[model samples]
Target chain A: MDFVQENSLAVFGPDGASNPIHVRDTIRKGLWTSHTSGLADGHVQGNVVILPEVLASDFLRFCQRNPKPCPVLAVSEPGQFTLPSLGKGIDIRSDVPLYRIWRHGEMSEEVADIASLWRSDLVTFVLGCSFSFESALIEAGIRLRHVEEGKNVAMFRTNVQTEPAGPFGGPMVVTMRPMPAADVIRAVQVTSRFPNVHGAPVHIGDPAFIGIADLAHPDYGDAVALMPGEIPVFWACGVTPQSAILNAQPAFCITHAPGCMLVTDLLNHQLASF
Target chain B: MDFVQENSLAVFGPDGASNPIHVRDTIRKGLWTSHTSGLADGHVQGNVVILPEVLASDFLRFCQRNPKPCPVLAVSEPGQFTLPSLGKGIDIRSDVPLYRIWRHGEMSEEVADIASLWRSDLVTFVLGCSFSFESALIEAGIRLRHVEEGKNVAMFRTNVQTEPAGPFGGPMVVTMRPMPAADVIRAVQVTSRFPNVHGAPVHIGDPAFIGIADLAHPDYGDAVALMPGEIPVFWACGVTPQSAILNAQPAFCITHAPGCMLVTDLLNHQLASF
Candidate 1:
């Protein structure tokens, strides 16, 4: 099956048939290894960041200092993989379908599971992912073109600088959505309810204002076409932590491969601060 | 004593001890008739509107249709003059310090109390005022120019239209505040906590985009100078409902005089949906 059909079949069916924990379990057992854009309809998906205990405190401070992009959802104790705070049975090592292995801040390869690489000093940090807010946006009746097209949402690195913490410091990375101004307001109101995910847009008008010179040339993800009358709205992205980790260039670090998120049993609606 | 000083003494001091009920009782009496700003810290101050029951349903429909500007905090029973749902011992006829009487859309007079003009056919609507969000802004450490300059907030007519309901139909009216882009984000996050009170900004950046030709020439309230690098942010003002009332040209209506407001027993923080 194609990527779209494969990902679609994993979710998009009946309500109770597929849950977040079940999706994670399927991923853990090597039965599924694909992008999680549309999977686990009503649960929270998290961005994973694992590091040695020595560098964990600095990363914690980094997320605390810059919350818009690096919204920390749950942090695990040293050597522990289960994030009980996020859900009842969440194992950091194998829950996410794909894991990225990095050495000296450079990605070496993507693996199905990190059970072999797990060390006693490894500390896992689950950061809020944009999927939570995207769920909210769709529920508000706002049409997201990327979802319809079955494409990866466009992401870019901007000149906006995040407040630095210890060794973790870098430019803010953001995800872009082309939306009409009217829908933009509704998007802001809807996303603002989910602060655990990236809260409202940081910049709305000209891309140049935030140092993005061209909309067509995105630094990271695939560039999507902007329809006429649709302004580019940017939100701080969880990829920022990944960028920071790459910059920090630690001896060893692990992150969930893009499109392979840690699915938790927590309901998305439960994340609404309101 | 001057108006500000007299009202300030009642709510201000080292302790800042004026409770919402205490402030409402003082306003109900003839002792206080000044603006209720900064009084009863952490309590909600509502925009008052009284109309005959004949127009009550239409106005209620109007508020329902256009929730951003007319967030219904409390709606009184027909002709009851008491809003027990909002607070204890709260009488709409006497709780507000000053009332403006409008006849056929024209301002006829201002009075301390509407007891003499009370009618069983009247209905009271207490709207979530900007004061609640403004308090949130102040608490977030964003400076409001009008509050800092001791002037009324600037308000203007916008080209944007509210969803129409029966006889209540008119262009949206908005309040403006100038702030640096950084503070604008802070302001958005702060005000978003109180959706009942005009919530987040409706527009930002250029005033001309909203059809206002000049920043200094507002349709109502005082115009404060815009400082360097400051952008004018607009919020759906409660005055839109008043303008809608004027358009309908109701035979008789009452509202809190400009600056003067209805002090409620509900704490401002309690109105935060989050």
Candidate 2:
């Protein structure tokens, strides 16, 4: 675990971690180089995707065709690092805790910042993540297994194909959560309010119906125990776009590192459609 | 099927059946004596329970404690047969299409009009029914199997117990609807908006978890087919309060017959909490 200096922590009080701007400032200064999971409670953290202007139009069309998996929260113009709509002084190059550099569908390196690699024709897309809805579920008294076990949510590449745009199209990716039967209904209601963050689940109950062969052997992330009376609920994941992008194999692209997201000024509750 | 006279139908146009006042007036004239399903399409229909003033307080408390199963829509004062709050000049004695007279738990007779049995001490209670939510679900494009087959919804007595008040205590009764995995999520969201009408489902997935052994053998109502790739979703039924009242064995009581209900002026969309 990465630790912040005691003197810096004193400036924002004990609950400074809950402040989105403060958390972004810490990342800007290179003091926080890890995942932004627990930091900035109640604020929206987005999945970052930066691609060249040439591929931006095609990728935007792909996201439009598949809004459930790749809901666009904000998009920055080519060569512009600032996303004014999401927050103040949001530098797409440095605000994200860590960045993954991709070369022709393959990740080549991970770095603290992409400032040196920034290009004049690069456009940044900020997509909604499931963290916001997970917070709402927890507040509604629904306990999530992955959060309890402190593990990455189990994600799977399903047989359901995404609507294609140019070279970006692949099987949809989904995050699974095991919950009690009663909580499953509440989870649906709670998550339905956040349409920008995948909204309600695409499929529930039977995993085989969605082409998932085994619960224990997930395509990505660590698998958690599915208790005796619990049923697995699935949501369209932000990782879906990453999968589509990788399949397209663009010459040069960048995305936030797994678990490391771009913290935004938007409140989680503000995303509720109701 | 009982048909309205052609002359009477002409007076209200082709959509006379969708008008609540016309439906009630037809019931008042003894022109319709069967179940009230499919009549007054966009209006709210309620499960009627009439008891002596001595038992009204206890029954009210039972509904308050177990709101999801017995959501109280309106309650009439002692000796009051009219429910002005529900509609104009709505008389409880003859508004329902059919009524069952219960004596010490066992129903003695089914009658179209209860004018002869009206007592000054009788108090009427109108509880929200699932018909309101079902209308909302269908409008959202989720196909219901029982509705498609034109059969009564399958109901069962679950091991799950309702909160007790006075002599009212018994196992909860649930209405089961088998829908495709995707519709199940939409059903949860659609029904959640109408908390007055059973709200969200109580249990989903395995029936044995809720103590039901066979889907083919329902305790009440007609059993519908559960197709492949579809999962059974359970919602608390309006029959729950009736079951509780039967277990209590009130010396004298009256309730709307199985499918017959009290049609009200309240529009179905008005019940949405959102």
Candidate 3:
């Protein structure tokens, strides 16, 4: 595919995946409000977490405590939404395709823009998502069953408890991908190079070892069929914060709606640990 | 102090930290068989290790098992000394100012060059040293006590065991740096960005936690006096491979003499994790 078209000045690909600026511009103008799976192909797509100032420090600590599950990409100052470190003119209020508002740990509503809901005491945390590593896997010629089947990754809530920071404590949620034995080793090495995006697999082979009773059924997202000679490899998922928030029962918070993310200017390779 | 001298083309002042090419050229000609500290100021300096191919895989695995303590920068093919990835026109046999040959796990002699001893079955491993992160700390306005006192960083043999691979197994070695209370956090953040040269401190504040008994006594290197407000911060040291080899007792090996290293074309900042 021609990654960039000569005439358009924008990268042209399937579903306009070439230009991150154009994707964000469309998102900012309210013209696009969908999952950013195929858009801005190589740029980082973040899982957003916005919480009150009182809970911000603890959440930051929580992320630090569980780096593999919650690798932080960028954090914004209180009441400040222009995250210039992540992109050129990213106004967090409108850049994310969709936002979910949580009130007292309850999911209240999903909206296109969060400008009306922006509060002076809110702090934003942009966390790395699996899309970054998936891009790397694809580039490395490792076939992802989830992407090939056009299904959301199978995520399961495990008995593997996370190191709690304040009230943020819950079982870690992980997404599973089934691959052959040889790819398992390569997957670990490749993912370790990208610690910012959940470095390395948390578990490989058996789902039962981590308290998951069934590989055919998952807590969230659809299950892709495990092929012959393929073993299930699990990675700490970004949805973990959502799981922790539900248990912690914070007064108020915001997150990107499932699959709808804040696409940043940082290329996927830029997030590599090396 | 003037970091660079006005009249000298070489990074002026104190021994004049010159270009890496110039330093390498001088070393290759059998002159300048001294410690490489303060030479090639901004470039990456490496811990040299050469072992037979039979033990090479195990040593590589050992380094991976203990990344913080033994971060491998590059590994050369059997009998291959030209590490093109690390620098230009680099002939490993002559580029390093000094070489120490170990026979039956005992240091037999320190030599200016090892071309005569080089064998077809030998493989080279360039492990990262602390100079990369120390340079970063200096840039960040963090004063290193060892550097200020003109002494080597204090190194300790800790009870903290390394994950063994094959015959390579031993207690990890750590280096200590003392900094004021406020700089400890900044130091962690700074060093974490340079994982190649021992990322974020293994421990901070207390010495007893990692099994070190006395702050005044260290296993290797001269100890620097800890200032009143400064607390000891410890990092996994590159001396670990030497420790491992000592315990493993390989028949033969070659390493750079302490403080003498293989300086490469790679800039220190190029090793940053970010």
Give the candidate number with the greatest DockQ: 3
Better by lDDT, candidate 2 or 1: 2
lDDT for B99 in candidate 1 is 90
Q: For candidate 2, what is the TM-score?
A: 0.51
Local lDDT at B111 for model 2: 91
lDDT of 3 by residue, B1-274 (tens): 0011122233233445467877788788866777788888899999999998778756765765577898777777677888877899999888887788898889899888999998998888899999999999999999998898877889998889987766988888999999898999899888878887988899888898899999899988887788898899999998888889978888999988887889899999987755
Ranking by TM-score: 3, 1, 2
- Angstrom error at residue A120, model 2: 1.6
Give me candidate 3's TM-score against the actual structure. Answer: 0.53
- Give the Å error, residue A245, model 1: 0.4
Using all chains and alpha carbons, the TM-scores for the candidates as numbered come to 0.52, 0.51, 0.53
Over the stretch A6-52, how does candidate 3's per-residue lDDT look in tens digits? Answer: 12313233456567887888778776667778777889999999998
| Model 2 per-residue lDDT tens digits across residues B130-210 | 899999999999999888987778999999998776688899999999999999999988987887799889989999999
Q: Provide DockQ values for all models, in the order shown.
A: 0.01, 0.01, 0.02
Q: Which of the two candidates, 2 or 3, achieves a greater lDDT against the reference?
A: 2
Candidate number of the best TM-score: 3
Candidate 2 CAPRI assessment class: incorrect
lDDT of 1 by residue, B23-68 (tens): 7777777667777777777888889999997777567657755767
Tens-digit lDDT string for candidate 1 (A34-113): 76766777888888999997787567657755767987777666788888767768787788877889999888988888
